[model samples]
Target: MNQQLIAFLAYLSPSLFVITALTSWYQAGLRPTAVKKLGMISSFFGILSSLILAYAVYQQDLIEISTFSIYGLGLSLRLDTVSMLMFSMIAILSFVIMRYSLNYLDGDHRQGTFLGRLAATIVSVQFLVLSGNLAVLLASWILTSLCLHRLLVFYKKRPGAIIAAKKKSIVARLADISLLIGFVLLYQIFGTGNLEIIFQNVREGISPLLATATIFIALAALLKSAQFPTHGWLLEVMETPTPVSSLLHAGLLNAGPFLIIRLAFIMEATSTASTLLIILGAFTAIYGSVVYLTQTSIKTALGYSSIAHMGFSLMVCGLGVYPAAMLHLIAHSFYKAHSFLSSGSVIDLIRAAKVTGAKRIGNPFKIILGILLAIAMYSSFAYLWGVDIQNEFQLFVIGGIIVLGLSRLFSFALDSNASIKLWFQALVLSAVVALAFFSLESIFHFFLMGNVPELTIPSLSEVILMSTVLTLFGLVVFIQIFSPILNQKSSFQALAVHIRNGLYINVVFDRIVRAHYHKEDSNSRIVLEEAEIGKYILDSKENNNEEQEERLA
Candidate 1:
């Protein structure tokens, strides 16, 4: 693959999407059906371009294309392993979501307009990943959010959708501001916005200006990822179209960790920003994991799941495990896209699920045994694999987190009725999964070798923060095991209510919003009500047909 050809193929994707957007807008009213075909074509083209870009970059580490220069920043497309990987993932996911949308918006009006906006949004993200300059990155970041805002509020009649969009808009602007200011600060300090040059400066020293900018960037990532307490909008966005939800969750929400990795050198330079990421990411992960279990609605449950996963990704980034975060983000995007697209099937599964009455608590002895076994398994595997806990603390702690999660499996295996074979099988399964995780971690780290550096030596406080993450997840496992007993207590019940309502975090945002955009939204569930009404009508027709058959007989 020639560098010039790779560049052309990379540019072809966004160019195709730009054409699709324009065609959709112009022909939406006249030939609505054609809009989808055009969007899918553009998306599939993007996937092809991504694969070619990946192979070309593998041969020659990086392919840089400087289109032009403006305001101290070069408008360039930089294709490396990280960028190429993200490109392929985003392109493939967008294509799948677009295909799903063909049936999703079957009879919607102005379908062309929606597909156009969606295509435009996909292109914005595509450009962002390929960006080689801070200026281009910031521009693409803002544009991505702006384009998605329309999709979030696609159901204008649904007040829930409107409110979610409003909340997200407010947060998005704050994120943009923090990111822009971070760039401005970096530009003032380094006198250039070329990311490579700035990265070099970052290695020289961690000055006050650099640290400040890094903290601001961290704040922006937190907001973009919808970290705890400010995550209500993410959960309440269920009123929007399913495709919109999938795109936002699976594609857009990953921008936070991606932003961290893009500026990996700066994040590695400043311990303050890294600490901030660790604290917030740990809290958000724990909060999301715990609260999601109590959610009755599928979208909100998935919403919490995204939050938890994002937090974990950020945590990995803050720990200087950039490759691990990348892997986590890519895997989560696929799972979340599938989760949102097949949400109807999930609902059916839940309906068909049988609930057992009078749950009994697992034996405390068994729980303790499970925890010990999980820890021993992880420790032994890490040692056997030559994972130096003292040196490579990042890999060690992340691997530990996965094993703690496996504690649940161990607990189940330790059931009183379980045979010795079951316990042995559980241990073997744990080893296989643990080995796979370590294998993937090493593979991504190898691919990202020089590009994403690890902190090798851990500071005392940093080590404690990572320890806290492991502790937090361990507590979650314990809670799950004893939930049957805890559910009976009033205090636990009250806490569940608060968690279910997202601890009233969004209420503050709502109050702020109502002060400016007050409205009578008491009965603003138009979309859901319409769905129910349609179902009712269909059921009535079925009943009438059955009666007619009986009369004719």
Candidate 2:
């Protein structure tokens, strides 16, 4: 529990975890069940050690352990609040996924190798998150990417998965290269790779050149986090196993935000960089939300939602709400992971129902669930925007309440027979309305003396305008849901198709890579086949010639 011991354990855990996973992989060939059990055992120990180190870090101000440099890069580990939080989450989630994969990947030929890479990824991510210096961070970042790229392609026999894996590789390598370049630039400008020292110097006043270097670092974070325009790779990454998807998209996806948070701390005094972050974050949030509204596949929908949530976190950071952002990040990781796991179960249920001659009946529970989710999302948005019931923002909040009510009414109309659905809808709606009202009243009291009293209740005309707009948006979504049944094409159908294609961003990238790099010629396969035939003919001719010569002799 001492600081020194914690630092030592933190420094040693990554290598030990990887070694343990590799050993298990070797044993899997002979005893698959035993190997899986070993993996779980190793993960349990790793998590325990990480938690102890986290406790030590909380007791001490900071824990640092320095070892000799490797290849001119200093090997040091630091445990702080941010790093400890990330490490603990990764440890716990990776262990759960490893346990789940035992059942999920049963009887797979490459199960051992897949599990090994998974372990390696967990270690690499922990190292990257805990690294004290840029050199160490960059090394672990690249290692993590490599491990993920391999796991992405574990089902290489599936052509689509292979293609997706290749795309992930390209994006990950680009991110790695960007990170490396940023690190070199930082080192050159700051004359050190230690994050703590650099942050101190930056707080004082970094040079213009170093500020430019910081921009590059920000770019790297944006790409790694799957910000707008660079988010194509993340969508395709769903080809990986469900547990991997849960870990990568829900757990590891936060790495980019973590990096941004770190940078925000370092560059707190830099107005220009902060402004850029705000703009990027706001743009990505809006873009991602628009995309999310149109997705059909549940996982892909969640992917866009993840991007949007991260965007919200980034925006909160931009607004100088670090605690809020961190809170939201933690909240999102749990909820999103649960949603994905539930989605996998839903998929299985649908499959089973199909096999039993049961038509895919609409579950009234789903509608109630969707309405509850909408209310939660609405409240979160309101809270983030500083809305109070007594202020002008209250109009928006009230409008949201009305919308929620209307949505429940629609749910009732759609599923009149489901009493459970009606009860669930009523319960959730009442709770949401009560919470929103209380929050609004509190805000109103805070600004009571201000001139914005009338803002709480918009004029009748204004209410009509705002309500009309929201109703239109809701109507669009509703129509899209029932359009197929109505035998009419809805405008939202086109939007859905576009989002499903990921806005053609990947297609554009594929075109650019193909247009410049040139693919192997289709004729190459034909030529290879012809060459093999020619070789056969030549061997036959030589045999005939030998037979003729022997007869002549």
Candidate 3:
């Protein structure tokens, strides 16, 4: 319960990860089983330390520790509610994923190297979230990218992995420069690099330089989160390893929204930055979601899903709903981790379930009716949850999106049967969604009371933004309800191909990157083939054959 004890506990987990990572590399003579046991032990201690820190922070509002200083910058850590939540997530996921790798990479020649690097990456991200100074935060951010690049190129002979890592490095360098500029501008304006001082200055009033700094930070977040143009690397990196994909998609990609949330106060002051975040994030969300529907590769689909999720998170931050963004971050992390780790079983799972005949396509009028019903359900649930109908236009629109999705899902369920049991199930499902919405909102309101400024009313621009997003999602609902009818047309099929090809966006980038960086015969490094599902299926078949040979021998 003491502040000093909390600080010690806060430092313990990352230190344990770093020490274990170093030992894994140096103690290479140990058997694989012994090395795995060491990893398990280190992970357990890390989780335990994180649990202690979480408890301490829950009891105390916030805890700050300044251990030392280099130059004029203080080496400090701030354990607030948000940072505590992020720390716990990193500790838990690292433990689970490392355990998964024990079997996932059982017989690899460089298993030890992979484990060490994974631990090192985890440590860097943990430090980044907990850092109390801008200098330390920036250094940790860059360190995380470097470690991820190494993991991306773990199979050095694989040309695809090499290309993906190279492209990712370029994007990350751009992000790093943006973040550095933002930090310098902040220090110049506030006359201090300390986060506390900067936040105090932001609270007093926004200076002219603050808005420019916030825009730089927003740009850095967009790049880091793989917004539109920078998302090619994310889709291509699936060649590295499953565990690596799990870590990158589920853990590292979250740093972008985390950065935005960390500076929400400054961002709220700048309407230009907020509007930019809203527009860009909304566009990315729509683009990624559509492309995801077209992709055949499971990892590539998941990559697009990550992009969409991150965009939506940024949009929530732009709307002044910081707590909701945090909730989105934590939920998406766990969901994507499970999705990636279980990706290999997808084919088996699908084969086990037999599909019945498809439902008859609904007419346009019926689909329109479904939309209106969804709006009604959303309104009822929002009222029950005490959502202010007069204000919070963004929240109302978001609730409508969720309800619309649920309606599409239930449309199929209700089409088959008119039974009371099915109807009861649908009602319960809607209630669960409503309950979750309010529960997360309540927790966020309690923990992040003053940190994130409240939105009083929606501006005209915000209203337009809200309408555009709702219309986009509404179109998606309409398409889902009547897909069987639309797919029969030729134009629809042609559009499907383009969407599946990611509208040839990455193709343009591929040529530009190769022309600039690749002097040798780069004929084989075409990025279009990178996201094909067949590539992974072939790789799996080869691995299976090798395992069969080993067993026979």
Candidate 4:
């Protein structure tokens, strides 16, 4: 295989997708059959070309194809391990999504336009991932945001869709501004915008401006990944078509963690920025997870779960475990995409099954046994893998959490089983989960061998932060285990109401944003039903009182 040909194929793949999409939108706008065929053909070429390129890159080590230059910076595309992985993922996922939309929007008039925008979005992300320079990366990032915004407002008449797009636009622009600032700072310090040069400089020595630039980069990532107050946009964007939601949650939203990993060397040099990432990421993780459990709408619940996953990914990057973050990114993308696409069947499944209430079964002995198994399993694996526990305590903690979750799963399965064969099956399932996780991590670690820097001994502050995170993880698990018992008490219902309302955070932000900027059509049917938090709380209390009166009668 010629290396040049391989590189050309890689570029040609996404180019084909873009060209076909534009042609379909422009020429076959009214012909659904023609549009669908073109989409399928384009995606087929994309997957084939990406796979070929990935194989070539793996055989050839790394390839940088420079096309042009401005001042000292080159407009270039690189095919390294990280870029190859991302390119392949984009190709495969786009193919799946495009195939799905053929049936999903079979008769929709604007199906051609939807497919075009979807292809454009994927192409933009591919460019962002393949970028070898800061200038190219920033341009690709902006393009991706614009393409996704068009997909988000597929139904222009829906007020919720419009408002969500508006909110997302505001946050994306803020993120862009932060990224621009970081770029300027890096150029000023390193004297070039080339990523290779910048990274090399980072390895050789730290710059005085690196800390400030890294902080700006982290800020951009936080906004892009929908952290905290800015996350309302993600939840509200559910009015878009299901395929669009799948792409947004699973693909585009991962840019934050990817950006952080791309600059791992810089992050490793700046402890302050890393610490800030830890704090912000930890808070968002816990916040999103809590809200996820309270949602009734399946899509909205999935949105919160995406937030939690992204937050946890960012936290992993902060821990200097960039390989683990990459694995998380890839795994979450596939899982969330499938989850969103198949979410329509959830109601059917639930209606067909028995409505079992949460059981009050808290066995202390089992819990203790599970915790011990987790410790033993993870510790043994770490030892076998020769992981440096003295410096990488964060990895150990994460491994323990993973194993602990699996242990609980096995315990639940065993508790319900009556036969010895069933118990054996549960243990086998637990082992399989552990083995799969380790296998995936090992592959990513191999690809990322040189990317991550060796960590020094943990500082006192980092130790305290890690301890805090462990405590929070334990707290979340404890709540999950015991919340059913507390739910039966009258006093806990108020707390439940607040939790279900997302603690009124999004409600307050929604009102302020809409009051200031939203200009909705008077006759639009889309209403902000969840915006009136106070009314909801009051109504819940009145309903409770009525239920009590009826019971007394």
| Model 3 CA deviation exceeding 4 Å by range | 27-30, 70-72, 414-427, 515-553
| Model 2: per-residue Cα lDDT over 1-553, one tens digit each | 6656666677565766677577765655433665576668767877887778867865765666667565335977767766776777777777778888887888777677767777788888888878888888888878877877878887764445666666667767777777778778778777887777776677577676666665666666677777777676677767788877887876777877777665554545444544555567656765676688667788888888888777766655544444445556766787787777678787778868845221222455656665665566566656665666444532453346345554544444343444465556655665565465445545433422211112224346534544554454455545533433443447656666776676787679766545223255757755875887899899999999999999999
Q: Give the TM-score of candidate 1.
A: 0.91
TM of each candidate vs. truth: 0.91, 0.71, 0.91, 0.89
Each candidate's clash count: 0, 1, 0, 0
TM-score of 2: 0.71
Whole-model Cα lDDT per candidate?
Answer: 0.85, 0.66, 0.81, 0.81
**What is the per-residue lDDT of model 1 for residues 305-355, given as tens digits with 9 covering 90 to 100?**
999999989988888989889999999999999999999998898789996
Q: How many residue-pair clashes does candidate 2 contain?
A: 1
Candidate 3 achieves a global lDDT of: 0.81
Q: Residue 415 error for model 2, in Å?
A: 14
Give the distance in Å from residue 354's predicted Cα in candidate 1 to where it truly belongs.
4.6
Candidate topping TM-score: 1
The TM-score between candidate 4 and the true structure equals: 0.89
Ranking by lDDT: 1, 3, 4, 2
Question: Model 2, residue 276: what's the lDDT?
Answer: 59
